[model samples]
Target: MTHSSTAPTDLPVMLPATYRGPDALGYCRWLAAMPVWALPVMAGLVLIWPTLVHAQTVYSTEKIMGIMAKWLPLLITKGFSMNVVISFFTMLLGTIAGLLLGVGRVSDNRYIRGFSWLVVQLFRNSPWLVLLFIVMLTLPFEIRVAGTYFSVPDWMKAVFGLSLPIMANIAEIVRGAIQSVPSAQWEAAESLAFTRRQILWQIILPQCFKRMIPPWMNWYAIMTMATPLVSLLGVTELVTLSRQAMEAEGNNPSLLVPFYGFALIIFFAYCYPIARLTMRLEKKFAVKG
Candidate 1:
């Protein structure tokens, strides 16, 4: 029977191999583990690859670099200063006001609490542009200091306007963080014959610092970004000067993307780290119920 079945011994047949080398198996595993969105991103890159290549070939990369080099210093020197000064003063005033309001919110007197709540609500709910315009239009442009004339700059008005909403938001953050401490903490402090003010200052606030830090940094980053709103008040901030620089570039519509992209990169470079730090802090000091 075996001899009869061996008639086709010389015929060719294909057999599948079951074994793969370590490298092949590893590559397959890595591909399987990749994020679901990776394929779409790769596909998008493939689609845009030709356009990028074409643009690079058609345009002089050196010319674009030259333009960026010319304007970047001016933007940094003139535009950056205005943003920094305004943001600094705004944060300073806002922090002071926010601390006061937060303390008032927790005061024994109902009037103090109501007044603080009113202020927070009034400022927080209003649009920043509206506040900026109101301050710019309504506030006196000049003040006499010790019989000397001093004119208030638009940037100063912008600072005051920006501070109002920040004050309100920070007040809420302060209030919430203070309130998050257990009632047992307050009771324990009271049992030890500690005054309410003493307890709040020495015990509660120290503990609240960890909780407050992340939100404070988050808001600071937001306020820094919002400094561009000062441009509306005629303060020459980063955005305003960016426009001026663009104008100097012969108003070339094609340059819009690059100029704006440069600004975006600058802002991202500054703000992204702060954002990442905030997230890291939030994770570190996350209060378990």
Candidate 2:
């Protein structure tokens, strides 16, 4: 009878006894138990790395990673920066429009209330991409006034497109926040010789500010994510610039993962902290019954 040097022939012989990795069957079982999206996502990166390294075409002295590193910062400067600008302006415009629409929703005048509700429902239900196309195509690129031409930039159109949905959403947020204030507050303010406008501006709206904030931040994050859609409009955002970089590099198939991967990383980096902060604020501001 022969003694085995390794009882576990399937496992790594060099690994220390305490840290020997899982055997193939155990690893397969573990993978099977993971969520549906988890395996594919893990596999996409893991499977692609070695394949690209072996197959990557060396057009310049630079390797795939170095070329990617050079462009990553460029992506930030030339591309993702525009995305941030669009998101900021979109949020600002939407907040203002939404405030007016929300006020209208609560207006005593039936006409104002009906108009606000109609605008909200229409924009809220429409697809964002459709809105973007509508706005971009319908608006003139430039208009002349007094022999001077002012052009509407594609990024501005993106802002308008994004703002429509945001405005509709924020209007709902405002309406809900305003209504969440007790009717007693309104009645009490009315009894104190306050006009309807005074009751809203002085008493109800002040209380609603905290309630509106978490959702406003949430929507801002969402609008940031959606800014990538503007790339379709040829608005020079991250994805569009990434494609341009790839083309300049002779469109190596291998660069797809690194370029898009870095973009994914940057977008994730920007949005994830906002999401965490959103959760914390929600918990912090949650009202007790």
Candidate 3:
């Protein structure tokens, strides 16, 4: 018997199918719940494994300890004495400049806005290295402060050069962070008869700072790492010292690895804790929000 067969087209599938089975979902959730440190540790192990395999012999414990003792003190001193100091001051001045510039950027007055825009555009568009060179070499000699015989010092020149570009970037970050605060919060402050300054100081800036800390810390870390650039102007920071030490150990092929590696470890040691703290603060703030 012949029967006519018809294609069944009762219902169309709506949602795209994905292969997220229960076990897979559970595994993903478990991975997501793991501490952040696990990933970095795993990555480090993966990176170092090849190096370890290729090495002819592992470093002796005593040799490693000797290397650490010789290098660690210098690293600590240089990082704290110069890198940290420069970074802190740079961040502080940058924050202040950025705040003012950002406010000027949003000002209703066209002249103020245009001037700030020009400053931001010029600084932002310029290379930091070139600006650093100009400030250190050219600016003091060429442009004296009006009615003052005292010219800016090379150190101050370096600081200003490094800081201004950072300030321009930070200005945009500050502006965005400020704008991100709820409009309702601003309105509520106004309803309470608060002055602009009072509202900004009391209500807005606190929340903005909380949001800004991570990026601020990141910027500071970068600046701290860049302390070596100061050596170009004869500032003699850690990297300079490392270079000197490397030169002192002339013709020793193995010394370069330990010298530079030790210095790198120092930088990472200084930076990692701050980065972790920033992450914690960000997480806390996220939870609060």
Candidate 4:
């Protein structure tokens, strides 16, 4: 490449292709695209954090990281996996319930529509932590069905709690997606003597599917990050189990950064890609209304 000899060495680069190179947007994408473990590894380099040096033998950063490495499996299996499980189930349950609720919001019946709106507002406005606490406290520990008792697990309760908000948000997404379809489609379908149900299921809903997907993925990311809230309710998900592992390993001040920071790093690792893809889908499916 040819360049002016008088060119300043430190001017921001502009890539010849794709309009990228340490500019604001490119820099952000680059940062978010970093390896999953990159942030934690960076923290490890700062060895011997002054604030973490308590009144005891200061552990080397290498030893702190080694401790984290040794307990990595437990954190992933018992802790992180539960976060995944809770997020998955929450999204699943929420999607089903939300779809129904969304349909209800647009239902022809006044009562059904009113009830759906009320429910959506109530749950969507409620604090997530409060909902978790309410579900954890109010639900029976065990239930009887056909003279058989099955006990509810704490994590399951957390899933139920999280699902409520997800359901509300998704209900809104569904309603909006459905409404975004041009009214002319509905009118044209009706011109063909198609019933409301037929138009909705076959014509309207098919178009709404693409519009709904990006928001659905976005909500899943939000719900996954919120899974850590379960830790406060004594659920043994990633954050909760992370703390237990820290305690088992002596709860050194130095361990805090690596352990909790590791959790944050992995969560970002999981969510950032989804966020990027969501943006892409949103652009691809941009509804010209």
RMSD of each: 16.3, 14.5, 10.7, 8.2
Error of 1 at 245 (Å): 1.7
Candidate rank order under TM-score = 4, 2, 1, 3
**Backbone collisions counted per model:** 0, 0, 0, 1
lDDT tens digits by residue: candidate 4, 173-238 = 889878978999999999999998888889988888987887788778878988999899899888
Cα-based lDDT at residue 162, candidate 1: 91
Q: List model 3 lDDT by residue over 18-100, tens digit each.
A: 45533312222333355667545654553453345445535443444465467658766864367667767778888899888
Greater lDDT among 2 and 4 belongs to: 4
What is the C-alpha local distance difference test score of candidate 1? 0.75
Strongest candidate by lDDT? 4
Tens-digit lDDT string for candidate 2 (147-229) = 99999898998899999999998898889889989899999988899999988888888888877876788788778978999
Off by over 4 Å in 1: 1-62, 287-289
**Structural similarity to truth (TM-score) of each candidate:** 0.76, 0.80, 0.68, 0.81
Candidate 3, number of clashes: 0
Residue 24 miss distance in model 4 (angstroms): 22
| Candidate 3, residue 12: how far the Cα is off, in Å | 20
Top TM-score hit: 4
